[model samples]
Target: MTAVRNVHERVIDAPAAAVGALLDRLSAADDPIFPTPAWPRMRLDRPLAVGADGGHGRIRYHVTAYEPGSRVRFDTPPGGGLDGYHELTVAPLGAERCRVRHVLECEVRGAGILQWGLVIRHLHDTMIEEIFDNIERAAAGGVARPVRWSPWVRLLHRLTWARPRAVGTPAEARLIRSSVDRPDYVDAYRVDLLPGLPRDPAAWTGVLRDAFPVLARDDGELLMDVNTAGLTARASILVDDRHVTLSTAVKTDSPRARAYWGVVKLVHPVMARTMLRRAHRALALAAPSAGERAQAQSPAPERS
Candidate 1:
């Protein structure tokens, strides 16, 4: 088969060790559910074999290489019989950040086109598609570092994501009265929940309350008005049968908001909505109220 290259990378605001450990979960044979199970979704079910003792299976794989805080590799069954290899590398960039790269190659006679297509599709779905979600989860709990502004905040101590804003007083909230604002530390975040739950406003309100511990949830078209680190933020959750969208509004018109918007727009428009739905489903599974349980057992609404 014609050899092709597929490389993708994402900035994870996490130390290399943390990101590497997360990557190692990709081959946990005992728990196939780990590492997000991207391959199974793509119709490849055999577990990724880890260990230098290379053996054979439906999907043979070997951890050909590994560096403590850097790279990892896997050799997969080629053309369902021939030899093939896939490699993953993680590079740490000091500021609790990392860059990941995935490479795959195989040899097959008279099957060049099909092999190339499968590898391309697999890499896209597994690497480009799922890496963002993985990075967000990895960095969620890391302490926020003082954000580096885009050289235009006009003040030495004040670092804005993309705009100028005085970070000292709460009254400054009035200057930027919309969702976009000058955030103290701006990084992309992802929120995920269990699958299979009701996608409705009531169910979602509970999910937010649990996720952002300090954030409060109340009833209204005004979903949530959160108080955190002396800043007041607004968030709205819109839930439909198919998805839930969580819209957050911070009082600063900073570059952080822009970064969040940039990543969300590039990754997937429905990402937030899908995550909200997942959260709602998770809440239901964990502590189901009578009403929520009833809703879960009911048939899903027809997708119009």
Candidate 2:
């Protein structure tokens, strides 16, 4: 059967060896990009080696080929309706420059098409660009440049998935307002609760703690750390069966830090909304049953 393929390529200022080394390190458990708050977290079961098993989140794969400081590929199984391979390669340009390329080739059918068509394709493109930007930045002594979505992309996202709310501070239980004058980025999404699910704040919090590692959920405050941008920001996370809101405040004292964060902030809406949406799904799955809710709300039995 013929396979589908996707390729991403970018030139970096660093030497081939440096780029290769960084990519090698990234191929292992600790990826500089995989921890992106906007995307799902990835964990490798072990270090990169031919025939080793791992992939992002639930996408399992085994390494098919490996070459130190050059290229590597992983092959996923066929049963998931996606039997394909992804590869990373680096090539030198003189002593101080190189090209980095990532390729995906696989046959996807059934459920895989839905997953890829709906979510993974867009996120993968955006992230691959950011990874290119990151490698360039790292090679150039850590100068910062972040990926920004085009208006068309943002518009499509809004039209397809997220709804627009008026720009202002929201009333409690209302949608999040990300409006800010100086540093611009805003995104919010709201969806109705699924049938048979009731808003249970306690159960929602439990699901969040287990599924997401980005937001530090606490009684009165929330915090997020996007180390790549050197941002330590405060966010508000509130949940109920009826509505869920994720909000954050942005301010910086240092001029350099402000400038850096300003660039990264453009993608915050996509990042923020994506994360909260996942939380919403997890909360739905973990929603307590009717019987359990009734038990909790019921009054204690009176003494005989």
Candidate 3:
């Protein structure tokens, strides 16, 4: 028997339970996003069940393992030469965000309808990609809202000093304060590519599929990370004034990190200049309110 594997990773704004529930729902339905034709019309019975116990071709496969908000596993038999497992893991990155990984592994038999390497490969890749794509759509509250952390849901976060551990010297304090902005408590950060042409998350996220060749070709993973943690970037309209504050307590004395920082210092000015130019272009297009314009033209406060 030949063996094959395919893996996909993504971060989403919804909770792990939400993603898992959607997957389970899809499995329960025959026409669950497998492209209409092959998706057996939804059967009234347990549609997702398949394998010896589930009634091969009826349910699809046997649920070998199931763990809520953690993982779910299933497999097919050897006769089909496509026995494999699907593992879904949810990692809480922020109070309301989760990182999801969907992985698949299968054994290819020497003789069977799906024995051909090319055919099996295509099936493994495309199907797995579809799984994540569907999950993303579902989690995004497509036509339906996914689970979310209410204000009552206490997220795990703690305040740390500007320095990681060791007390910062006077010089260090000045440098650290100059780069980072004060932390703001709110929903988690969501980092997705800047949407296409118009840069609108709503208008772009839908049509953005074409820009991603991996997804456009229907053969790739849509790795996404969602978090209410400060790490995420917001999905705001370009017209609004957006300010992103990046903060870190510098306690680590790691040699590697220091080395990288050393390199950054060399060209920081050039980078700043480039960013200013970009900002200028954006300001020109959006034209902030008069109040903002006045603030920008005002002189900076003298530092003590």
Provide the TM-score for each candidate, comma-separated.
Answer: 0.37, 0.49, 0.37
Backbone clashes (count) for model 3: 16
What local distance difference test score does each model get? Answer: 0.43, 0.55, 0.38
- Of 1 and 3, the candidate ahead on lDDT is 1
lDDT, candidate 2, at 40: 31
Clashes per candidate (backbone, < 3 Å): 12, 1, 16
Write one digit per residue (lDDT tens) for candidate 3, span 167-220: 212222232233224422111111112111123222222212223221111111
Cα lDDT tens digits for candidate 2, 1-304: 4367899997777688876765676544334423232333344567767877766545677888889788888888878666888788889989877988989888877776876776667766775776676565445434255568766545444444423132233344221223222433333344344433434433434323334334444442233432334444444445444444555555554677679877777876666656665565554435532222222344223322
Most accurate candidate by TM-score = 2
RMSD to native for every prediction?
Answer: 20.1, 21.0, 23.7
Error of 2 at 141 (Å): 3.1
TM-score of 2: 0.49
Candidate 3: lDDT of 287? 35
Compose the digit string of candidate 1's lDDT tens values, residues 15-95. Answer: 677667656544333221122221221112333334553432124566666665466676764555445776777787886
Give residue 86's lDDT in candidate 3 (0 to 100).
Answer: 61
